[model samples]
Target: MSDIHKHIEESQVTLSELMLPSHANFGGKIHGGYILSLMDQIAFACSSKHSKYYCVTASVDTVNFLNPIEVGELVTLKASINYVGKTSMIVGIRVEAENIHTGVKKHCNSSYFTMVAKDDNGNGMEVPGLILDSKIEIRRFLKSASRLASKKHSKFQETNFEVEKYISELKNHNVIVDYKGYK
Candidate 1:
């Protein structure tokens, strides 16, 4: 709602850390939760920088882990504001893992997090608009807007869903209907 606008680069954040054995899972690969925690931290930093206020995570969109990170690999996470509403921003994060020996990097995960700026009293505060300058920035903003619309539509469908109408369809799947009252 603020008249002030800022560029995407103004608030971008990147974090890199070497993956340790303690951060690995029993399978020897880095734990997904640890990476997620890192992503959240970067998202928070990026959004807070942009808004100039304390920000809290509202939601996180699809997180797809494409590659497994190994112990001793260097993991890098990049976060930027892709879109902004009156008081909320969608932060896009990209995670990559690099081999220390070969210097080869692979895309590990991509996620979108919705963050809301908050005031000292814990109420939502208005955030500055984005000044998208490049085609890529505009594309990212449009995609985030589309994704938000799709999420709203999905929620609407869920709210209006009728279990009785779809109950019989469950039989076609792997689930078993054991209740006697639904006959």
Candidate 2:
């Protein structure tokens, strides 16, 4: 294994950018898409560092816009590889915006991105395992990791006939399946 492949055991990518006038929307607030682009880049950096190959976003489970980031604040993007599959890895991202003048910080968004590692041919490729180190990081990772696993299971259930039948039966038994947009 190459030295660059050690990204799984412990890795963190941070991006600091001053609030730019170009990044703001008409209301003078930074757009979610702008933040999302930074998040995506951070996630991909971490993933590529781990796999030492190119990766692409397979899915973004949910993106919550917790708060509006005003202009003139510092936006920081953090991303880490939390879980790995045969050919996919789940990255946990937390976006925080800080007012440097006031020292006030608030979480702007939180999201999980799944990346599919591929060879030059675009076929699925395996990735190494991930190791959790810190207590706080471990706790946060557990929450996101659980969601990642559940997301995969739900996707599988949708594609498999037996799982769909079971879900239907569970629904008949009054189990509520949360409805979400597929696209």
Candidate 3:
């Protein structure tokens, strides 16, 4: 078996693009679907880069949209691999938005994606696990993992439905939320 990594070793992926009119909602904000679309793509990118294998989103935990973004801005998605299980990977995603005209950027959302590695046969495959090495990264990974573990799927869905629905509505309404500066 390959050694696990607690932190991303190869590299991290940052995806950024301009806010097209099609990506905006009735409120002139970026659509939630657009953000989630990018997040899923970036998550796949990070997973593919690391394992060179096919990966799929098993669950997206705590996708929090604390604010909104406007049109004519740049949406940036940054993803990093934090931890890995036998055939599962825990990814951390942070979505940011920048006003292309003014260069204002905000941290609008954060999410945890669990992916299952698969081979060409579509069966679950083994992947190198993530080994925690540093203190800070370890803390963050542990915190995320704990939240993921402790939060039951049903409860997570019910309690976080507001946030989830907001994201869904963002998709349906094509809402735009700008980023808030990361603390």
Candidate 4:
């Protein structure tokens, strides 16, 4: 943690654009990749603004496309720093699409992007601590922290996992095991 502290509102960013025909996929809806690109850009901007250093995306959490966007719809991405670590920040991004004619909006996606601040040498750098002034901010920070802890736990389990110990359990699943070596 750095000596400096900043509020979450200081680093909030919102980007809106009209979906173009070229951004559509074979099914005639806006492409998921294009929306993901926009989300990445907004996450970078929000994290950089809070950290005051160049940032790189470390990982993106669950991104489920809940709704499809049409070519004429207006897409909006809102990003904010939800949690800050010594050198990394978790950015919460919400994506929505609005029909221009109907003035109706639908949530397209929600994702959490982990970004790390970098120095000129491309090494990780410390970021300012977050000043949680509201219950929502506190909840967001705690949620991000919990998610990080869960991810670490999952990784640890994977590393020490014994396939042979659970091989018999595979019979309960949809998978078909045909290896002759397995008794």
Candidate 5:
């Protein structure tokens, strides 16, 4: 197969939806889960458009809810491929809510979703290389790379971490450790 390269803007996806009363929670605010579902949809669309294959969400690196979306606001989700590996792409999503009456906009959430391209047989498939055109694109790619590295290092620490040493460190927080249990 020939190598494929794509620009970051080539596969960008944007979705806008009006929040309805049915989508609101008991507090009359739009549900965060609803917004997350929308983000996942846009991420899938962006990655699939870029990779030309079905994509699955491997992991969600970060999801920061900056502001609460209210009912009757227009919510927009923008997604683009921030970074690409052989078979994986990091889809960065930004969500915003606008008050239709006053035309005020609020940043709702930001998230990064790691997606893996898959063939019809459910095997991993190669994805197109990202062509970063601007400084912002390059910065996003580098940020995603660093986030991925941090995640791996954190996993390694979690796997081989020493509980005995950790217990001592817990003294910095408000916690009482009763070491009576047998090892």
Candidate 6:
């Protein structure tokens, strides 16, 4: 283990479980919240493995459920370190559900979790740098960087919001803005 860095592959974590009836929601499908919990667990495990320190989830960037998970299907979550900052790492997770009888798999969701390493004293600790060894790893690292940049830009836009400028943009979407009583 290099003191300063670790390969992304070395920190990958995969978890798979058979979906049980108890995991389903009132609609009779697996609940999104349950899958998110599993994703968070794998993110913590992967980040801690890479950083060699205790870590906590800073934020979950996105959780887009592409497909619904069915009860009795096998669900798998694969997590890997996408990018690492001084004390933070982005864990990319891919979720898939498989039908056991048919051996068919469908992508359920993809999420990015940001985790920050902490020392025993609960202070932020420096984490090992990521070693990108493959194209996919490099792409993920770039994607994480781009995502962070976009988030910062969005924050700035929100802070200095202009309703007039967005009115034209909102026209293209499913929005109806009445200017008479608008803030």
| Among all candidates shown, the one with the greatest TM-score | 4
Per-residue error for 96 in candidate 6, Å, reads 1.2
Model 2, residue 143: C-alpha shift (Å): 3.7
Task: Give model 5's TM-score versus the native structure.
Answer: 0.92
lDDT of 4 at 36: 96
Clash pairs (backbone) in predicted model 5? none
Candidate 3 worst ten-residue window by lDDT: 159-168
Ranking by TM-score: 4, 5, 1, 6, 3, 2
Error (Å) of candidate 5 at residue 62 is 1.9
C-alpha lDDT of residue 182 in model 5: 28
**Candidate with the larger TM-score of 2 and 4:** 4
- Every candidate's lDDT: 0.95, 0.79, 0.79, 0.95, 0.91, 0.91
Q: Which 10-residue span in candidate 1 carries the lowest summed lDDT? A: 155-164
- lDDT for 25 (candidate 5): 87
User: What total of clashing residue pairs does each candidate reach?
Assistant: 0, 0, 20, 0, 0, 0
> What is the C-alpha lDDT profile of model 5 across 82-181, one tens digit per residue?
9998899999999999999999999989999999999999999989898888999999999999988887787338669667655666679988877765
For each candidate in turn, the TM-score is: 0.91, 0.76, 0.77, 0.93, 0.92, 0.88
Q: Which is the better candidate, 3 or 6, if ranked by TM-score? A: 6
Which tens-of-lDDT digit does each residue in 1-183 have in candidate 6? Answer: 236878888999999999999999999999999999999999999999999899999999878989999999999999999998889999999999999999999999999999999999999988888778888889999999999988888833767986765666776798667678455
Tell me how far the alpha carbon of residue 82 in candidate 6 is from the true structure, in angstroms, after superposition. 0.4
Instruction: Point out where model 3 deviates above 4 Å.
Output: 4-7, 152-183
Q: Which 10-residue window of candidate 6 scores lowest in summed lDDT? A: 174-183
Instruction: Write one digit per residue (lDDT tens) for candidate 4, span 65-99.
Output: 99999999999999999999999999999999999
Candidate 2: RMSD to truth: 5.9
Model 1, residue pairs in steric clash:
none
Error of 6 at 177 (Å): 3.7
Model 2 Cα displacement at 111 (Å)? 0.6
Residue 146 lDDT in model 4?
A: 99
TM-score of 2: 0.76
